[model samples]
Target: MPTMKLGYLKVCVWLACVAIASVILYTVVMLSRRPLSLQTSRTAVFTGGHLRLWQPMDLHGIPLWDLLMLYMTQLDNPILKNATAQFNLTLPGTCGENFHAASQGLKNISSYPSHFQAFVLSMHFRDYSLLVGPADDEACPDGTQLLVAVKSQLVNFDRRQAIRETWGQKGLVRGVTVQTLFLLGKQGPGDGYPDLQALLQLERQKKRDLLLWDFQDTFYNRSLKDILFLRWLQGHCPSVEFVFLGDDDVFLRVDALVAYTGSLDAATQRGLFTGHVFQDTAPVHDSQHKYYVPESFYQGTYPPYVGGGGVLCSRAVATQLYKASCHLPLFPFNNIYLGICLRELGLVPQNHPGFRTFSAEAEGQEDLCAYKELILMDHRTPQDIIRLWRGLHDPALAC
Candidate 1:
């Protein structure tokens, strides 16, 4: 009897161990399967009529939730991501519809600037056709590696000439075949400008690199420039490897830009979007400010965006961005609008040390070594750009 009791007691102990193990496993499985609390204050914040997900670091130590969020980040509508990770729990649809609807209602407001008015009109009507452009075959010829498309003002002929004579010259640098083009919009007498079409035509005939569209060339219309250019790029330069889009006023270190792009790994090269990044910035409510954003127009912080002074991106990324832009409502600020499109693709703009969009401290502004180390710098005068380019190329100069 004692032997039999000992054997039964051992079996009971084994059964208890098995039950405990099963309970632990069940708890783990349930935790993993639990519905992600996207509604939680810690996970999401409603802004600009969209839910912005918490940064990945914010959710540290929560592996199961991270996994769930990562899955959501891969969804078709990708606006939920922050700077590092993406998570969208909202109903699947383009988030820009809300922005379009909101801006549509505000079109009748008399206080809005003409640029903002133009942007609102664009949301409903995208019929602004390309008045003049290069032949599709000639825009980005075969063997083109880098296409530098400068956003030039209709009046900045000197600036365009300076660029062509220096960094914007079309040729092979470090074996990278480079092509340069200028983007222009209409600026005729109706907008208080003399008819410079004859001069423009002469320049175009000589250079064969101007992409002109039939839209007003105003500050707010800059976003329209981006949209129109992307469409051109999609149709004309589809096979080009890389593109550098920037203001005409900026100076470029083409060799450095090429080297930097060449160093990117295959994955990064395929999705490269790097420059001076702006994050966590909000639109100003002050009407006097250049970047004023009325609450009725757009609400929330700007997404991570490269400064418009200079941005470098791969053709593939540019293509994807163009597609993403289609679903987004036009933002007055060109850089911020591109950033929104990046968010729509679940992409975060990578900040690089080379792109200095804003001018450095006054002391370093003319330093040759400082200029040599950067890929691009903004707010440079045409003469200054030419002088700097010559200085950098001088054999006697040592960094």
Candidate 2:
């Protein structure tokens, strides 16, 4: 009987040993397949415009479940051969700051063959104002005092209450201002409302007059419709030094943008338009999409590249663009139309290194975090913006 009991105990000990071994093996496999951490920066650069920073992750050997799932589902996964490509990137920063130097170089490009102003100098520059769509509370620390023309859009009684209850109460963040704009007679295409009228009303009551064209509508309308509105806005806002057209989804690091503008002289800055410029000596032209603009529609050649989401145009450039818009038939595409207008006006589309029309997800910018340490535009959800603001609080995670 004693021998029988000893044998059973022996078997129990063996089972326990096997269970421990299995766990060890599983852990090893997971560790081996973990994502790699890309090189990092000591600090983040804040570019001009609504550039929203994100929550910083340690990024070291993080689990790749998301990546793996997407990879398996793809018939032609670009990621399978080079898994975690984004995680292996080398961003620009202190150690050589290669990316930063390259980006800064775009601003320094000289107008080699007698500056462009020499051509458009004859055209009178137009004064135009900007229309910032909506300001999600996440993007603004203090309401934009500069948008005096549209003060009501920023101030809201009900929203003020929500901000305190949702944000201030958590101790996660402080005052945040987000603006929402919409077409007349329509609320918005999204699930939520930001009380755009409240903002506009507040602006009106406060006697702020900075808004260029007050009519409400989505910018995604017909190209001709957008041009008409642009014309009205330029005509009305005579004090507009330059026009910055951007969406509420983005946060322009205003101070950074203003500082950069200060760095350039009036002459150098005039006739200057900057944003992400697509270049394809031979780009595929699709006419059906609203983005399609034919060369025949315009008097001159079709411009090589332009993106619509966020564009910066100087007063001189604005006048030339307006004049050219009339001669050049409207193209359904928002960016291409601007490109054609600029080209016909004999003005060039200067690429700004800081411009980011799309996030790393859409544009395939692998070293996005590092290159975007200082960004003019970054696409992020309002909730995402909240978290990003949180991560910045930790001293170790600022970069």
User: For this target, which candidate reaches the highest lDDT against the unseen true structure?
Assistant: 1
lDDT of 1 by residue, 105-138 (tens): 3333456777666555554333467777777666
* Root-mean-square deviation of every model: 11.4, 26.4
What TM-score would every model get versus the actual structure? 0.73, 0.43
- Candidate No. with top TM-score: 1
- In order, candidate lDDTs are 0.72, 0.40
Clashes of 1: 0
Residue-level lDDT of model 2, residues 196-298, one tens digit each, is 6665566444422223232223333324334544554454444445555544344344444455565778787776677778654332235454233222211
User: In candidate 1, which residue pairs get closer than 3 Å at backbone N, Cα or C atoms, i.e. clash?
Assistant: none
Estimate candidate 2's alpha-carbon lDDT, on a 0 to 1 scale.
0.40
